[model samples]
Target: MIDPLIVLLIGFSVIGLGILLVAHLFFMDTVQKTRRGMAACAALTLLLVGLQLQHLQHLSSGADLLNSGPYAFMLCAVPAAFYLFSRDVLLPDVPLRLRDLLHLAPVLAAAFLPPNWVAVMSFVVGAGYSVWLARLVYGMRRNVGRFRFEMFFFGLFALIAVGVLALVIALPWTGAPLFYRAYAAAIGVSVALVISVLLIYPQILTDIHEAARLAYANSTLKGVDVEGRLEALNSLMTRDKLYCNENLSLALLAEAMNLSAHQLSELINSRFGVSFPRYIRELRVAEAKAILSRDQRSSALSVGMMCGFGSQSAFYAAFREVTGESPAAFRKKQPTA
Candidate 1:
């Protein structure tokens, strides 16, 4: 009979890989380069885990192939691919130069290294990339609110990466086979955690990417009237209920405020301490609460539409996120005036 733990690990790995591939397909057109590199990393992770699963089930392929030159090389490349993808997202202003390819140098070394040396080198390289990831993520704390929704998950992923790096360092003692199992298990858990976050906030990735771009880009609000712009924004959102427009966007709202998208993003980030998307969502959710309380007869779907949500699910998600209660529950608790 198959070990239940191994079966569970394999299930998680496959599910994670499928979700990553599907997400890549959905996001390919918009964030082409970054998503492509991320997809590549996800594929390599799946390949490594799938091979481990095969060995775990059949026990035909001995530990030899698991620790072989090519397999080790692929294992070593995972961290590099993740690093490059994250670099593109966090430091996109720094164009990739030929020298950036040096990040993959360890992969070549791992390809030809002796079996024992492969594990040691993989540990060293993974550790370095893990540290680099820490620095990159930590450096963005100043603009944390820009991607606030993702910060917790990003931290979770960092913890997972650190755990994997720990596994790499223990490879010799635990043996290659055991290490592979633990690594694959970590990948599965990471995927499940990310998918949960996505289910809650489907717009997370796009919001993070937009915020990261604004976080790193040079300020475009120089010489601009920040106070006046805030006043106008308040008027548009409050008196006019501009957020009620389903088609409202960062660029469109920026135009109304007589500011560029970047300027408006920076203004929102600096003054409101949130991303443009979150700012709009908060306004919409606030309006939603009022409608839910005041207009007892208004259906939840119509109220969501009137409050600017594009879909019923989106409205419920955002409303629950803000109020900690579902729309129906929140409405039920309100006293009829």
Candidate 2:
């Protein structure tokens, strides 16, 4: 019989698949949104599936080692995903390749190991890698400026707490059950959920909570009176098709609004609570959807170029940053009208 948690994992499979499908649908037309975090979520779901399978297979490997293997892969997935999500939500200038390389570390390592060493190596690497992610996340909080990644921090703390529990269970003074390792497996599932919460609908949530607080406090602060320019900004956003420009910015939007860059930026910060680039991405993503829907023969369209991207690479990065799906993958998932 399936355990309660396993039942939930099955449920998660359905939910994750649904999310991935929806994410793909929105992303295909917006060919240039962020999918790094989405990819991480999908990968984590797969990780969970693999773990469930391992449980059913009743493999003779050490429980600790077996449990840890999938987790190690997960360790890479979360941080890389976090990096992608945060970069999209916070910093546009950061390179996607940089974040991507970090996530692939485990797969890279696998090439060097003999088959028998895979289990122990996965456990050791997974446990150690998660610690590295926690430390890195703390550093990101400290260094990445004021718009912090609260989601990654949440997951990091939970993982750290779990690690402490695992250590406690392993202690000679502690009479840990041989089955206690399963407790840690549960943490693996929790980690995925936290990442999902932060990535999906983050812009909407972020807009509601911290935009006001973040607006006036930083060096990037736009200003206090934003409502005055909002109509103009909205007009420009709708009429000018600014999103079609690959390099849209606060200065540009401000220029169009007949306000100084400083004033315009302040207005966006005050009104929208997001930096200009992020605002541009959100708009661009919305536009992508319109274009995709309006044109039935989407194959005739170049998804990346049509979205105001200077290049496919730039569009792909922006798309993943915005919508959490790759262009091709998203298109494949779209429902036929």
Candidate 3:
């Protein structure tokens, strides 16, 4: 028999996570669909925990109660809710259409089917959604940057979703009552980890919102003169020496060129085939090389600072990344006057 204290602790933790997620809906500055999807996920989690607590208490027919139609629907809906949340968070511009509801048809079907069939259907849906979620995360790997921390937490949630489904399906085969308790405990822990991270770094959600908006803009903009924009961007960096600003940012540069940050980011990624940071680093390294060749007496650190590198370490790293040699070594190779 599972300890009553452990069940209570897990139940309260899941309830706390649900409360936090709901609170986030109000606290978030924007009214995005992602918030609603997250709330749905939290509700499902709470329901699942409640069902598990009932089972642990050994109330008459408690296991049967958990296997009932409503419980099966909630079990199946959790992954679907997570998928919806992930889609909204990662691809906000993609409208949720009627076809998306088809993903939940299995849950509805499970409600009418045998209890064993419900478990089978839920596993299939959860496993497929987990793979899809993983692919979405992989695609965003290049652009996520500091947002990868949030991605890691979401990945944990996805893994837990799959593990829970597997444990449910394999429970009959293994005849291991302990696996059910383990599944409930895992869900509680996963929710706690996600909620704690988000509360600590709420900016992650804001960053994701901005990134999704930028991605949407980049995809939809059309009829614009790519060549002209490229020329303007080059002029800003080469002639105006915007790259020489240590505090330069995509948004700042975009504002100077009368473009959106997304537009500028897309231009750099498509035209230069590099991210904004890499483009700036290349420009700074090129300037540093010119200074090194022209003035052999100048220290590498001085040239690095003048060229807009924020630190000597960053200067050397970027220099070596571009030139395959340290700045000091590259300077040494230059001929004396």
Candidate 4:
């Protein structure tokens, strides 16, 4: 009889995969390289889960060794797709070279390995990719504020990667079927976790990509009057209420400050220790707080709009992030005449 725990795990995996497919259809752009790379990662993970399910349930005869080649190939490809996605996000200016193809040489070697050794080879390659990801993440520590919420999701995946490595290391004792079930469960949970984060923070990847550009790329602010430009930016935002324009953007603000978008970005990063978006958000939220205190009867939505938030939801999210309370709650806490 099949183990009930394995059955439960497989069910969770299927639900997570379903959510991922739905998200890819509705949420993903399908054009950007980073999005496409993420889609490939999701598709490959779904395939691995399906294959593991088939093997565990005895859905096919001669499945174990015969299907090993394809499974190992997909296993190796997952990390490759992920690394490409990271590169596209973090270092987009760096052109892809022909030698990058060597990352998949393990798949060719997998065909030569004994069936029992295929899983080991795949895990070894995965460990290397995990280490590479760690290095990339470490290099971005200076921009942690930009990746604050996003880092939690990244750390979750990192922990899952570590768990998979540990599972592979203990394979001699736990055996193949158990390992397959555990791996499937982990992938499923990760897919669901990603979908949930995307639902809540729809702009998570864009924010991270922008942050990575600031972290990994060369400075674009050389020989510039950093102090003078920051003064101008502050005057535009605080004295002139430039942030009150709902259509304001990085390029537009940079133009007003007589700097390039990259220069303005670096200026904010180095001086204010925050991203441009967060800087604008803080200004808007601070204005909203003053408005709320002055007039307690105005609706939060109106206050949000007057302060330049695009919508009520955006205002609430930014306000909570900055102040750790809802607008109404904050207003009520204030001493009203």
lDDT of each: 0.72, 0.51, 0.68, 0.72
RMSD of 3: 8.4
Off by over 4 Å in 2: 17-21, 24-32, 35-45, 52-92, 97-103, 111-161, 164-267, 270-337
Q: Which ten-residue region of model 3 has the weakest summed lDDT?
A: 57-66
Per-model C-alpha RMSD = 3.5, 12.6, 8.4, 4.0
Q: 109-145 in candidate 1: lDDT tens per residue?
A: 7767777677667666766776776565555566654
Query: Between the candidate structures 1 and 2, which one is better when assessed by TM-score?
Result: 1
Off by over 4 Å in 1: 27-63, 146-155, 255-258
Worst ten in a row by lDDT for model 2: 208-217
- List the lowest-lDDT window of 10 residues for candidate 4: 58-67
lDDT of 3 by residue, 62-123 (tens): 36544556666776676677677667766766777889889778767876887666766777
Question: Any residue pairs clashing in model 4, and if so which?
Answer: none
Q: Estimate each model's TM-score.
A: 0.82, 0.42, 0.60, 0.79
Clashing pairs in model 1?
Answer: none
| TM-score top scorer | 1
Report the lDDT tens digits of candidate 4 across residue range 1-337.
5455556656776776676666655654411344545565566556656555665554334345324666666666666666665666566667778998887687677777765566667767766766776677667767755455655667788788778777776777876666666676677667668767765665455555556778877889889988888789888987999988888878888888888877898899889887777788899999999999999789999999999998898798889888989999999989988
* Candidate 4: Cα lDDT at 12: 73
